[model samples]
Target: MTEQIPVQPVRQVHLLLVDDHPLVRDGLRARLETIASIRIAGEAGTAEEALAIAASAPVDLILMDINLGTGNGISLTARFKTEYPHIAVIMLSMHEKTEYVNQSIQAGARAYVLKDAPAVEIIEAIDTVIAGGTYFSSGLNRQTASSDAGQLLTQREQSILKCIATGKSNKHIARELGLSVRTVETHRLNIKRKLNIEGQADLIRYALSNVIV
Candidate 1:
């Protein structure tokens, strides 16, 4: 005689899609609905609607757009992390800009994925985040290598970087910081080396894009 055993079903992950565009929500629903382990809890076109749904319904994860066109997804993500610390959020953006990605991470998003990323990548992001890990778009991996450089900078270097972001000259930065122009230049070179940025314009752009806050 042989005994038969039944296999347990996979857990369903409740997902909420948040975007200002209805078409975007529809597209996301179409792509995510095909996954058997995922069950879409709801959809929202604005921060208010998302908050409402989350407050009243069961939502395990959120696929949120960085720019809602009418609201800010990063701010909403901060709010969500504050109120619903258990819910995981992933920011979706059209561009692979480090600025947006850094903001999203600060706001407590578990992952950042490009809007044009393949569905498989998105699915991978969901699985990874749900399984207690972080994920970023493959296209932005190289760009994000500089994202953590801010932490490696000294306070003086960061101040110089901020000044450069505002279009200040090295001489001006030195005068403002009560340091010699040569000292400022040394710090500037160190900043460039740490960030792996070669050109002055690129350094300025990076400084402007990555606000410490």
Candidate 2:
């Protein structure tokens, strides 16, 4: 005699799609819906709407676009991480610039994927992030490897470089980051030395060329 056992259903990973474009969200929903282990919990067109939805009904992962019309997705990612540290975030952007990728990671995004990437890559990113790992688009990794800039700068140095690129003074960066002016200056010097940048003009040029707008 043989005993029959009931099969248990696999749990689905609930996801929130945040993009300013309706078409983009719809396309993502269509692709993600095909995966048996993934579910679309909600869709938001702005950071505010996303936050509101998440506050009411939490999701396991968030697929967020970098540009959200009037809002910035990177800042939103930081906010989400600050408020809900458990949930993972994967950034979707058109830019493959190393600075953008690094900044997104610093902002608490578990993965940085390009919008034009194949659906399989996106799915792979989702799987990796859900499995407590980080992922970056293949193209982005290639670009980062070619430049060698991302490897040279620490996270704090990257932040300082971004500030410098945006025309912020040392005093402003110090105040904003809660660091002393001397500390900011030291970081600036270290950044220049690491990048082999000689002067303020060269530093700004390097920062402008490397950083994403």
Question: Which number leads on TM-score?
Answer: 1
Backbone clash pairs for candidate 2 read none
- Writing each residue's lDDT as its tens digit, candidate 2 over 49-164 gives 99998899859999999999989999999999999888899999998776777678778887878899999999998997887656677656544522666665678988998899
Best by lDDT: 1
Query: For model 2, what is the alpha-carbon lDDT of residue 143?
Result: 41
RMSD of each: 11.2, 11.4
Give the Å error, residue 28, model 2: 0.3
Off by over 4 Å in 2: 145-213
Model 1 Cα lDDT, one tens digit per residue, 82-131:
99999999988886666777778778887788899999999998998898
lDDT of each: 0.85, 0.84
lDDT of 2: 0.84
Per-residue lDDT, model 2, residue 75, is: 96
